[model samples]
Target: MSFITLNITCSEEKRELLIAELSLFPFDAFEETETGLLISCEEADWEEEPVFAVLARYEVECRVERVEKVNWNEEWEKNYDPVIVEDQCIVRATFHEPRPDFPYEIIITPKMSFGTGHHATTYQVLKHQLQLDHKGKKVLDVGCGTGALAIMAHKRGATDITAVDIDEWCIENSEENFSLNGCDHVKLSLGGIETVQENDPFDIILANINKNVLLDQIGAYSERLKNKGTLVLSGFYTEDIADLMAEAGKFGLVHQEQTERNRWAMLALKKE
Candidate 1:
């Protein structure tokens, strides 16, 4: 299938917000540019109306182009760099040689999926995961783009994982990535948070979605967590921490710790 690219020029503030807004759509990859952001998705899944409608609200310049006969894997690998954190964790494409020195190395080809650990939100969450104990824990990865976070949890010794994403492309990309990493036990679910069965509660729930979705689903995360289970949240600005923390508190999830990078923050809350 061919891919379509969308270019939108907006203020830095609007760039991140637009990424969050557009993420709900079928877009698979997003890149922030000096002047704006570049978004890509399957040609069949691209919808001009919702994209332009969201862009119009923010008063950003928009351009759409369909790219045919493009080998995205080669294009991505040519430009993709390994995402390294504290010299400990490395998220790289398969083309990059493995780093045995790093305690954790995750291989994920960039198909424009969101959670490759390049973004500050994903980076902070990955760093936070390193600090938490995931041995034999049941984990849930909400908005599991590329299933990167779910794979990380597995490395930390999580035996059971449910990686859920609203985008089908993400699920497809995640399935491939999970296999690449030999994560056979990770359950890949394609649907909204509400659709996931809550009978099997999680010990650690990682959600790195936007503020609106996080707020709306805080209660659900609460309902799906085992007692004292931790919920790690990111994908919002640091200024949003208070609002998100307050909402999470209402669900009896107490703020335990926080980490920030590039103004994006990751918050860990424990079920009280």
Candidate 2:
């Protein structure tokens, strides 16, 4: 299907917030730019009122255009580059040659899915995962875009892994990536955390979604976590950490550590 592309030019200070707000809509994918964000959604899902309202509120320059459907693979190949993190993991596409030096190699075919280790949030999360002990643990990957994090957990010896997302395309893309990386054991589900049974708590939860979504679901995450269980969160600016931590503290989660890159932050917390 063809899509509407919103090319927005706003202050870098407002970029994260803009992306978060735009995410609330049916916008399925985002591409960050030097000045602002490039967002895409199916034409049928595009509502001019909300888009114009957000732009007006932010007071940003926006250029709206219709993008014809084309070969997504070719588009990605032209733009997507392999990402290497901490010299430990290499996230590449099927078109890239093997890098035998890296301990963990992830091959993903990112069609419309998000996570590819290119974004700062995804990179920091992958770096943190390198230091974690995932062996035989019950890992839950919330907002499992492209199933990158879940596949990493599986490779790290996590036997019981559940990856959930609200997007059906993400589920299908993640399944393809899991198979590509030979991690078919990772359980995939559609919808949010509520779709998963609450009978058994998880040893670790990876949520790489935006700040607003994190705040709204913090309680649920806390409830689903086992005592002393780890929670890693990203997809927000570093400046938002204090507010996020304060909200998380209300749910009995203690801040452990954090990592930042390019003004983006990933926080690690433990259930007290």
Candidate 3:
């Protein structure tokens, strides 16, 4: 299907508000670029409407431009290559050759979903997980896109692992990757944090979702965690750490450590 690409160049100060405005359009995907935001939408009925009408309502100055459409997945695979992290982990798409000596190996097939482990959120989670005792622990990976974090937990000797993603496609991809890595112990589920019913009081919980979702469900995580359980969270800007930390404190979660990579922050907390 051909997609309508709308490129808008605006000041960084107005970027967030412009994104909030454009989100109302029938956009299939949008990306934050160095200069502005790029939004792509499948052809809809409202072709003639001035996009500036909405932008003007929000007092945003943006330029609209058109671009040719191509299969995004194809373009992604062409650009997808192996990324080595911490000199200890290797991540690669299916077509790329992997280096052999990395202590940990994570294989990910490029899909529409996120969580390649190269993102700062996933990177910090993986690095933090390396510090813990995963041996025989029951882990729950919330928002387990591509099953990256859960697979690592299983590799670290997690006895039972539950991985969930809100997107069905992500769930399927994660399950496939888990099997690809010979990790049969990790369970895959398609749902949100609310789907975490069968498992409770987990020893470790990994949540690499955005700040809003994390804050809203912070209490649930604490309620479902065993005493002294650990919670690893990411997927937020560095400025958001203070608010997230405050919310987590209500659940008796104390910040143990944190890491910043590429302007994103991850927090490691323990339930007291």
lDDT of each: 0.86, 0.87, 0.77
The candidate, 1 or 2, that scores higher on TM-score is: 1
> What digit string (tens of lDDT, one per residue) describes model 2 on residues 4-102?
877788775576678668878998767555556767789999999977998899899998888777444564565567899998999999988999889
How do the predictions measure up, each by TM-score? 0.82, 0.81, 0.77
**Colliding pairs, model 1:** 29-112
Per-residue lDDT tens digits of candidate 1, residues 1-272?
A: 78898767777557667877888898766765556677788999978887788888999998788887456566565556788988889999898888899999998965756777777888898999998999999999999988999999999999989989988878988999999999988989899789778898999999988898999999999999999999999988899999998888788999899987767888999998
Model 2, 34: alpha-carbon shift in Å? 9.5
Candidate 3, residue 194: how far the Cα is off, in Å: 2.0
Clashing pairs in 2: none
Question: Who is ahead in lDDT, 1 or 2?
Answer: 2
Q: Which parts of model 2 have CA positions greater than 4 angstroms off?
A: 1-69
Query: What TM value does model 2 have?
Result: 0.81
lDDT value for model 1 = 0.86
Rank by lDDT (best first): 2, 1, 3
